[model samples]
Target: MTQKNNHTIARSWDEFSEQLLGFIISRIHHKEDAEDILQEVYLKSINNIDKLQEDSNLNAWLYTVTRNAINDYFRNKQKNKETITQDIFTEDTDALNIKDSFCCLEPHINELPGKYKEVILLSEIEGLKHQEIADKLKLSLSAIKSRVVRGREMLKEKFVTCCKYRIDENGKLAGEPDCQRPECNH
Candidate 1:
């Protein structure tokens, strides 16, 4: 019975992936996110295949799962947005100064390892707070804070090593792009 169920699922994926992906892609702006949702829908459908009563209903069931996944994505996105208080949005000169120096940082950011990379992108690039970052990564608040601190330290090291940036009198990053490292792309 399990074998037959697996076979059915394989057939369904082969037949419906393109159609489902099209539906998902239309609803989702990003191609990668839409593909991820489709993969989630596929996993859920296969894992619970026995719960599906009939093969005739497979397409509808897949669509339902895809819809639920899309809803989950938006729900999480909305939750992340809600976590940032209005106060955090206001520009502090110190933060703005640091952000300004950190401009043209795409390559440095991409070089960060694993979830640390994601944390920096979310917290620094996207301006999510510690709690918001924690919510997004499903990590403890302290863990998120630690990762942010650690990630920043690593990034600072990279800047110093790669671009020769140093602290100014005001303690903000100060340097011209050295363009020494090929990856620095300065």
Candidate 2:
């Protein structure tokens, strides 16, 4: 990129990143992922700066890019989630899969921060619908949904980062954890 464009990007970063950081974090559950997406927004905006119709629209354009990045994160998360299932009752799932896959899950859940822990326990363990959770927690339906999504993503992050586990094609946690992270022993 040219020096002028580089300067422009630097200026943009200074002007908008602080505002967008909170905005991005509001939608994203993981702090590292949210920061990564914010960086992506900056890079994408710089690369596509010339395409923007007006200089005045840059702020809005950045917001658009940040929003799209968050959407993509959730979209990919959903696709990854599709390759993992909690349904151990199905004949195809088998008892072995359940016994081996979830040995560390309860401990990880116990380690979760309060709100995340609460939502996961309520939805997954207590079998409460999102609406029912909303009623009981006195949270908005959207807030309840957001908490559930965030809670699951947080758990998935822990599994991926600490346990080094990935969901197999058959929707089970496959392979052993690397045990590189301090809390990764499984």
Candidate 3:
């Protein structure tokens, strides 16, 4: 690339980082994930710097890249079928029915053998793309995709089973129990 083009790319990147960061953050709820997406955007922009022309349109180009990344993230998430484990461990144990209703999903996640757990965590928690997960795990794209699918199904079944059997001593439904769990109290 010419020096002028290089300067333009650098300037445009710096000017748009803040807006791009916010845009990515809004799409992905986690702050850390948003930051990681921003980093990916920077890397992608740098690698494709040759295609960027006309300084005025730089913002639009950057946004397009971001939209693509976000779409890829969601598509991978759906392919993976990963359900976020709602954590409710810190609350009072007096509501064992409720506690049992909401057991720690980390254990279930831990049960996933091999890269399935890693793929699910990265795709769901870290908001990474399939390609990103493949790169991170040094596995083939097909392998990553497969793991996400099977792993998510396993988690869903596990969560459903755990939630179903949860009942108070009085045999009442956990959700309609006479008392509230400490975590839900607030």
Native-referenced Cα lDDT, model 1: 0.71
Top-TM-score structure, candidate number: 1
Model 3, residue 171: C-alpha shift (Å): 28
Query: Can you give the lDDT of residue 148 in candidate 2?
Result: 80
- The full ranking of all candidates by TM-score, starting with the best, is 1, 3, 2
TM-score of 1: 0.51
Candidate 1 wrongly placed segments (more than 4 Å): 86-186
Q: Please identify model 2 stretches exceeding 4 Å from their true place.
A: 86-186
Show pairs that collide, candidate 1: none
lDDT of 1 by residue, 54-165 (tens): 6468888888888999999777654443332121222322443334334435567689998788997788655678899888788999999898778766776666666676
Which window of ten consecutive residues has the lowest lDDT sum in model 3? 82-91
Pick the winner on lDDT between candidates 1 and 2: 1
Cα deviation of 27 in candidate 3 (Å)? Answer: 1.4
